[model samples]
Target: MLLIIVGTACGAPDTTAAEGTPETLETFTTTADALTVQNCSPLPTSSVLASGDDGAGSVANNTRDDRLDTRWSALGKGVWIDYDLGSVQSLSGAAIAWHQGNTRVNTFTLYVSTDGVNYTQVYTGKSSGTTTAAETYTFATRTARRLRITVYGNTLNDWASIAEARVCGAPATGSSVVWRGDFETGNISQWTSTQMVSADRLQVISSPVRSGKYALKATVRQGDDPINSSGNRNELVKMTREAVGSEYYYRWSTMFASDFPSVKTWQLFTQWHHEGSSGSPPLEFYVYGEEIRLNIGGDPGTLVWKAPLVRGQWQDFILHVKWSPEASVGFVELYHNGQLVLPKRNIATMFPGMLNYLKVGLYRSDTVTQVGVVYHDGWIMARTLADVL
Candidate 1:
């Protein structure tokens, strides 16, 4: 009877017979780790074991009993642990126990996952304050294999402890999300605009099409001015999100005024910045047309120009930027409609860090007011600078 009870209380760790006992679970060392994401490296690999009442512990077989770190307060009877779904997996259920001796933890939330790529809260409940801190809760669904337990701030202790993680589920069901847009309605989202300083009359059209593209019209207008000063000169559509420590390649298209005359200097701007928490100057990239040239990292250079402007015509353009440690320059190619036009080299240098925003739109600096009427259409697509080349 004693042996059967003991067996029921402690379940064996999951592992392949050929793999032998793997390493134990280790504490996640960084704050960025608390968020759900995949392919994270530079993490410590040793499992964390509880200190015997002294709050001191050492590394052992982490695979049998793993530990996760939580930013919650380290106060009374609370529980805190993180689950790494290994690769992206479909997670649906979880079971956890709050150390009963510590009375600080009174609430718990169970999170579910799919693709280990993202997680969503699935269950929540209050601790009775009397039950064995070592209690378990079962979930009805069976879709997730990665589970996590988060304790609300405890009154007695700020932290929580986990005795086990029983993940039961299958792998995620599909490919990655191909595309998405969070429309603020009549506003531009997921797009960067490029117009220079002193430029005006930019507007992000919200109605009529309801789900429409941003464009320039003889009389229609859509634009927003950024609160930053560097952008004071040229009006532009900028990407709200940014890349870090890597190069990026994205493409957008525009329609020049059918009436645009040859030799007219106009700029279509999309810029990124490397910023500090307190906010500071950033390395910038500026693209314009006098035959498609660029200003990178504040250094001015010209690639080449093939297609001039045909009145009332639409053209597609590609901007490729590389910023890895090996190479530190940005490259850009301008295409007419679909054909490659002039391609430039070492157009600009990237800053040491990533910029906070990506911008786009049309302007001509001292002459922005006149060219504010150019039409633009297309989506802005981007990936890590390393992925594209």
Candidate 2:
């Protein structure tokens, strides 16, 4: 009997799958007006200095000298490296660690400087050549004292090594995280999913995580099929960035499955969707029978908030929002577990020109069959709320 309709747009729509196209909205900007540095530190040593190296465990301080069997190599094509950090400092992100980096792929470019000769590029990608582990890379926090790395060749030879090199940032006061996914390097390669059809839905579990060691299991059965065939998905990850009009501060941690299945049609476990064409999802959180609702959509949809789904522990969430489709500049707040349960509230999260993108796992309705399981953990995305509460 699935009918909780608020403003319409819910259910029915699977004309044989395939629909995704929308996307193309851009316009982000908001470093919160920059310049905040309230006591930053971290950059004690990495005074590296290279343009050549290839001797004694591969020199250049073996990439910060942490030793994963040591390395720094460098040989042809543009190769460079620097690190200094004696002052300006206020950056955010960089983890590196690639000696064989799982055997290949590695193009790079990241720069920042306060004087090591005036640089400033910030980042450029490529590196999942997974061999010695490490990997992490985040950006958009800026402020620097010199940290360069420019490779430009890899997929095998021309060699650029680098076995360890971290940098992370803090001490800049007003918060700004912008993406995090605490799988702690056990790997989910960060995350992105169009509803991956099975590798067991999505995984990276170590023991149920709330902090670290890894956690992000999804799993949804009942025929599990609907990557676009309209609803009945197995969700998995989905956050390849996209949020407009700024103001974010999400956080995460969920858990369920103590038999979890009090279905009534519609199960969504997190969403923000909207990029247009086909509705419902201006925000959602879902599950109706055993409570735990939120929805939002527009033109009549609203369910505001709800709770009471207990099952098996771990909940936590933060969500701040500000986005906008204008209802006097959108709003929404919520805490749960840190308790502020839905405070600000104004609505209109988006649907004009569209923007908003995020997704978690296990969407339902297709006549519920059962077999679901959740368990996510520390997925951040900040810009304050003290960088994801």
Question: Which one is best on TM-score?
Answer: 1
lDDT of each: 0.37, 0.67
Each prediction's RMSD to truth = 19.1, 19.1
List residue ranges in candidate 2 displaced over 4 A: 1-67, 74-79, 82-146, 149-163, 177-192, 196-221, 225-233, 236-250, 253-259, 262-315, 318-336, 339-359, 363-380, 383-389
Model 2: which ten-residue window has the lowest total lDDT? 30-39
Best by lDDT: 2
Please identify model 1 stretches exceeding 4 Å from their true place. Answer: 1-186, 189-200, 204-241, 245-249, 259-266, 276-289, 301-311, 320-336, 340-349, 367-371, 382-389
lDDT of 1 by residue, 1-389 (tens): 00001111011111121213322212212322111111211111122222222234312122113222321223344344455544344434443333442454457777755444476777788655553322445555545434556566444554454432334332224422212222234344443443432333455553222124444332212232333322123344443333222234555455555544343332433444333222211233223334444333322122234343444555555555443111222444444455555454543333332234554443222323433355444444444322221
lDDT (Cα, tens digit) per residue for candidate 2, span 267-355: 77887776454556677887767788776753235778888898789899898876655555568898989999889888767654445
State the local distance difference test value for candidate 2: 0.67
- lDDT value, residue 274 of candidate 1: 30
What lDDT score goes with residue 360 in model 1?
Answer: 42
